[model samples]
Target: MKFTKFTGLLFVFMAIPFLTFAQDWHVGAFLGISNYSGDLTEQRVDLKYTRPALGLLVRKDINRYLSIRGAFTWGIVAAADSTNSSKALVARNLSFRSNVFEGSLIGEFNFMDLDEKGFTPYVFVGVAGFGFDPMARDQSGNWIRLRPLGTEGQALPQYPTRQPYDLFSFSFPFGAGLKAILSDKWTLGFEIGLRPTTTDYLDDVSTNYVDQNTLLAYRGQKSVDMAYRGDEVTGKLTPGTYPADGTKRGSPDHKDWYAFSGFTITYRLGASSGWGKVKSARCPVLRP
Candidate 1:
């Protein structure tokens, strides 16, 4: 299915509970850094490519130690093999940048009473769905979407194993954070969350290079040109130098991963109203 339609359904599913629960809620915004790990990243979790990320979240407290949250986040993730010091990677010279949009529903478990006046560490785990479009710059520096180019012989009858990847996929998100009560109605938090995704094409580089001649015949010269980007760094294309069909282009054993680390400031909804008072009385130890 298209990513937009899937996301719309996810929002509707999460929103239903909010309308029915009528519980204590907190609305917050976060600013942080995001990064990716995959074949193009040379297996290094480098901070050099970290990009700005922002998110909005709504949390409904189930008690002083547990809560449910729904969040939507936007971030940029990128990496380049050209920047690697390894000779093999520098020669590969592949790179990509993608904008990621993620929606998640998570359960948070606080190690201590969250309503207390001090700080507590918490862990969260949930299901997330995200959409990404990986892109790379052409010789002329124009950004070109890589998926449609069939860089790895995707969607071709000859390469049945190299099927096209979907732009939207599911993931498992789990992370830990610390939160502190700043006032009666405000809380400050810092967290780092990791997403282990189901797809390996987050960087648009996975599996082996296709037979150049066949790729050219089926997908056009642009596919053959992008299938192996080594020429981009060498400045000269060597005829018949492409990796043979079925030769390794990227590791297929491992999937991609992305992470976000940031700070959040939240406003406790209905903190001064009768509902708030009743909630505070029911959980007296949680009063901030």
Candidate 2:
């Protein structure tokens, strides 16, 4: 009997902390422009363009002054045509594109503590983990890889002619925004954010191209006759022969990585209106 009572007491104590967290769990989604920054913007003529983002977020206001928030955003950033002159092109004319999958944790300090306040200005700082795939694809949809002659008969139908640049990095994220309560249960808000990453190759630097304005072959497909042979008599497709994929060490042309930014509009969920409330009996208060 004593053991049973002790176990019951332990369960109740553990449940208390979970109940506290349940009070602050709210679901929300945001729409906004997502763009890039850092080495990725070295040749981009315009720093700002509109992109849309949607994500689910969960936030817990530990107290009026401090809170923890987490979110996942699906977004993209792209830049093209950095150079006007084709002959003088130091940068490739290909589009430097990045699809960003992001997850972040933010700490917010709300100035106004009231839940009904129409506008609350807050400052936030957090770390974001971004999974980005940056690549350039030409019109024919074939990745560009330089290979030796005659080997075309033996090469894989898909030999990754143009390889993907996978950029995974830790970034410092910061922003300021206003949240307005449109009604009892709904809040509409917007935020502008900046993120700084540690990569210098975002613009595809370390190559003959200074920017991304010259690799325009990606704009459309043309079947141009080129020679690729891998045989002395009939060469075995040995690595490092011709039409090399940019990944080769000591290659003059290689892919680069970059950082980005975003603007977002978010909708908040709570007992206020969008969803029906739970039965009163399901929620029992602890009376001491």
Judging by TM-score against the true structure, name the best candidate: 1
Across 1-288, the per-residue lDDT of candidate 2 in tens digits comes to 999999999999998776655545555776666665433234432455345566777777688567788988777666643332332121223344666788989897778853634558887888988876554444455533312211122122343343333367666778787766665555666676777665433433322211111122322112111111111111222322333443211122323322333333334443342223233325687999
Kindly give the number of clashing pairs for every candidate.
Answer: 0, 40
Candidate 1 per-residue C-alpha lDDT over 102-209 given as tens digits, one digit per residue, 9 for 90 to 100:
999999999987664367999999999999999988888889899998999898998887788999998899999999877667789999999999999999987888
Tell me which residue pairs clash in candidate 1: none
TM-score of each candidate? 0.84, 0.58
Candidate 1 TM-score to native: 0.84
lDDT of each: 0.85, 0.50
- What does candidate 1 score in Cα RMSD to the true structure? 7.7
Each candidate: RMSD to true structure?
Answer: 7.7, 12.4
Model 2 TM? 0.58
Name model 1 segments beyond 4 Å from true. Answer: 1-23, 234-240, 272-288
